[model samples]
Target: MKLANKRPFVTTLFLRPILLLLTLIGNYTGICKKLNVAAAELVEAKAVCATRLRLRLRQAQATATCIVTLIVLIFAGAGTAVSVQAITPNQAIDGLQQLAAQAEENGSIRVLVQLDLPFRAEGELETDAAVQAQQANIDGLQNMVLEQMADTNTAVIATFKYIPYLALELDAAALETLAALPAVVAIEEDIPVPPALSSSIPVIGADAAWSVGYTGAGQTVAILDTGVDTNHAAFTTGGNRIVAQGCYSTTNASYSATTVCPGGVEEATGAGTGVDCTAVVGPTNSKAQSDCGHGTHVASIAAGDDGGSIVGVAPDANIIAIQIFSLFNSTTYCGGFSNCVLTFTSDQILGLEHVYELRNSYNIASVNMSLGGGQYFATCDSDSRKAAIDNLRAVGIATVIASGNDGYRDSIGAPSCISSAISVGATDDVDNVASFSNIAPFIDLVAPGVSIFAAVPGGAGTKQGTSMATPHVAGAWALFKQAVPTASVDEALAAFQAGAVLVDDNRSGGVETDLARLNINNAINSYVTGLSVAVTASEDYLLPDDLVEFTVQITNNTGSVASQVVLTAPIPQPLSLDAALLSGDAAVVDGQIVWTTGQTLNPGQSLTRTVSFVVKN
Candidate 1:
């Protein structure tokens, strides 16, 4: 459960038998090829492998089964048939029954224990005093849990303020005792969240947002990744944009490399805490194991402003960099790689917890986490990180994450799979879904991620993935926050979706998805702010070829002048525009009338333009 820590019952009892069966089949094939044996002696074998995948019910203690069938193999060794035996694990993956099974198999387990008490969103508590009182209640519950498990070999691995849960390492007796308690709601394995893996400003219309003065000035975007190169030119071109830094890398002896934080500590904060992780992290065969610039690349894509050469989406937005990954060595944990980058869910949670704490101090609009592991089709609202995400959302902070780079047509990765989190997939410059992008109905949006040029640890570099795509949205959110300071996370997201272009992904053999490709310029223009527009017509009903006069009135409600005003009225097939009646400077383009007002609209000012159209069948 804790980074390759669990060795279940089936592995101990039935592993050898399955291995022997596979060995015979493999050896027989090689021998026949080398010895020129009779082809008939090695005949085809079709197998409906009876692999029992078990899952235990939470409170009912019942068993649910699934099967993995392996078919079509060339069997028969020594002119005799060779059988394949599959040994399936007792895959107890939920609640108390899982805890019991894990205990019986491994003597102890690591888990995220969810308590019965519901945690309130930040918005639910209207006042700071109310929030403090709620914190007191949560702290009391945590204290009670510690007291209950004091007698057993139980250790609290991590405690969270935003989420009502605890990461604990406990023996089977302790787990059972805790489950029996009335406060305990359910439990799940504390799974390892590994690193899943940018680009252009103009493709997403960031330039338009910038021209209109929404350059994300005074806003802070949090980047939780491997770590950033704070001294890189990408962060310090216009100004010293890196405002804050923190590190929360996990190091488990079984699966993780040495601690990546400064001084080799598990967690640290302040200057130099979030620098690049330059140690060798990949396998020995890897040519660039020492290159750990994922966070640096991700940060620059979100808000890095390096003169003009490699600017990110929010060129002027400040950054709060935090390190949240560790080097994992175990092949089981590293997806068969001898060494690779992975992060513990506990560390990521803590990193988010730290971000929540800094919310009051910084004008934080969003947190960018371009990291994930494992794919899911539906919302993973039950993930331990969801509590933190929900809490952040309640206070207007959005958590934007990568949908993953697994190329799944119908699923996305976890953390991003959480409903409250804004999951993003990758798209190329031409607006097609990237081949490596994980797609699903749950994906929130898509952004340009192919061949993205951004900041690496040393200098500007090129890379691409859903990881690159995510920062575009994060930076766009920062711009939204700057443009409309009072906008909530939901409002900003809705605005983005409102102007997003739905791009269809029809790759591979899976259900196709039409996901929203980010349109920052349109989203900003369409979002309600200081300006409001209204339309009226001369006639409510009209017959074919009837003349109808329509008018659009623009009003500025803000105290200051609204500059760079532009408007477009889409023309339907049934409507015919009378060019003679068109208002000043208004021209039709691609089935729409476009108008660009060079002047600014002052406070309480209104502008109206009238045009005539004919209704056609």
Candidate 2:
């Protein structure tokens, strides 16, 4: 074929050395035996006498470039060309056909067909009319595929709009025919991703914030996971703390539609009285409630209040359970056993969309997605899930995600890898990085995740993963928002990062050897301008009528010194402090031990004092 444009000198300069090397490599060994025919053909075709080659080069220099242009096109289309190279189907489609042949006795195999499409910003398509038009285009494309498949008596099982894709069930003959279609970019079998499978609140200093009365009260953190058990005491006071609930997983089959919860109301005011959406049902005989207790644990970790035994980081914060995963029958072997699939990307996208939709009514402060999969070394801005997160964040909601449990450098997964999401890694009680936490530059903070105690479906339990680490950060964000009502998402994230205490661990196999562990007290203290106090008892377990020693440390962390610093400790019943030992304007007022320092503490300065008390019978 004649070349369209000619740059003979430039083309020759680049291709001459490549052609020469290939010719030498081809002659020494039968390169054709090792190389694909396309590469071998080019090397063999360009083989000619030195004089003839020079003559052709000189001729091309005067007229046009053909050989180099053809070579460039061939390599460029090697793996990605769906239409141009479909005369010989691409590797992806070829693999599908092979799979079909292997499973011929089982009939057709299901595959996802990813199509190539131009990028269109969601904002540009924000108007109702615009959205409808874009959806119409997607539907039209899907209909075209369905019609084409009809010729072979095949059909599309599902269509994905967020991205131009379709799931289809086809035989070998039908798969080959579909592969030849110009619209098809790739065809691959649906791969099942298993669930990646938490914390003490005090190690993170959340207890300090609680002492100061910033308990995430009135804020709501939406959790997108398996499904929460609203009946759990952690999620209920007199009424359920779960303000809203929805199921986006397709495992139940009936709940496949993302419109609303199947068999459950969209919203409810109390526990067990709310939505009863269908539980996830996989072929492996799994249920969200019975088989997967992840969501309840995650929810409790973020906002549960079980009379203090298993208090969440944000004990009083409301919860919105957006169930995105349910147990499904596993089509492939899972860890040598047949376990149900845990989640899907489409379900996650739908859950995110629902969160965005409910943002206004619930005033969602943060979104806790303690679930992730798929390794993405860099930020995944192009994924639809990332887009959904960005959309929510644009409106002032913070998205907190778990760095994957892959334990590899640069292995943070999507949604979490998105720049807008606060990606969290796991740390143990001693502030050591968890061995399984994925480390990368994207990780925003670390939290107590190893053997974390939280509420599960049937009361409470302990679990571990970066999944556990994520909710701690999410709850911290809610606390920050409650403390600083005007803080934006960026401001909240920065405060949290600034408050993180750096931890050392060998588990970080990546360039980042140390991670910043979340410190909620520091995070809240960073935004407040005043003296902050942290109190501790010499003994945690004190018997009634026993002498108790308490130490209080007050620090002025603001830009200026805190004058007239007054430290007040509320004395509850069964506790009495010795008045004679009190010093420096110390007095007992309204059943509280008040120390009026009347002293100026300079910035970054701290003062410590010990007070003796006796437990009353």
> Which tens-of-lDDT digit does each residue in 1-617 have in candidate 2?
23434456457766775676565455534533454546434343233222233433433442324454455564565476633332244453547556677437546665667654443534444554545444455555666667767878465555655446676667777877887665566666643344456238879888878886778998999987766777777877646788887775443232122222454332222333223323443343432234337777888888889785779999989998876654443334244333454555656665677777787787688988886677887886645455567667766788898888988666687668888788888888987778888878767888888998888765788889988888998898888888776677877777776566666556535467446788887776655344467778878777776676767778886665545545544566566656655544567775667676566778899888777666655
Error at 38, model 2, angstroms: 55
TM-score of each: 0.77, 0.61
- The worst-scoring run of ten residues by lDDT in candidate 1 lies at 47-56
* Model 2 bad stretches (over 4 Å): 1-190, 251-289, 374-376, 380-384, 484-488, 508-511, 525-617
Model 1 misplaced regions, further than 4 Å: 1-108, 283-291, 508-514, 537-550, 566-599, 611-617
**Candidate 1, RMSD to the unseen true structure:** 17.9
- Give the candidate number with the greatest lDDT: 1
Q: Which candidate is the best by TM-score?
A: 1
TM-score, model 2 to reference: 0.61
Query: What TM-score does structure 1 among the candidates reach?
Result: 0.77
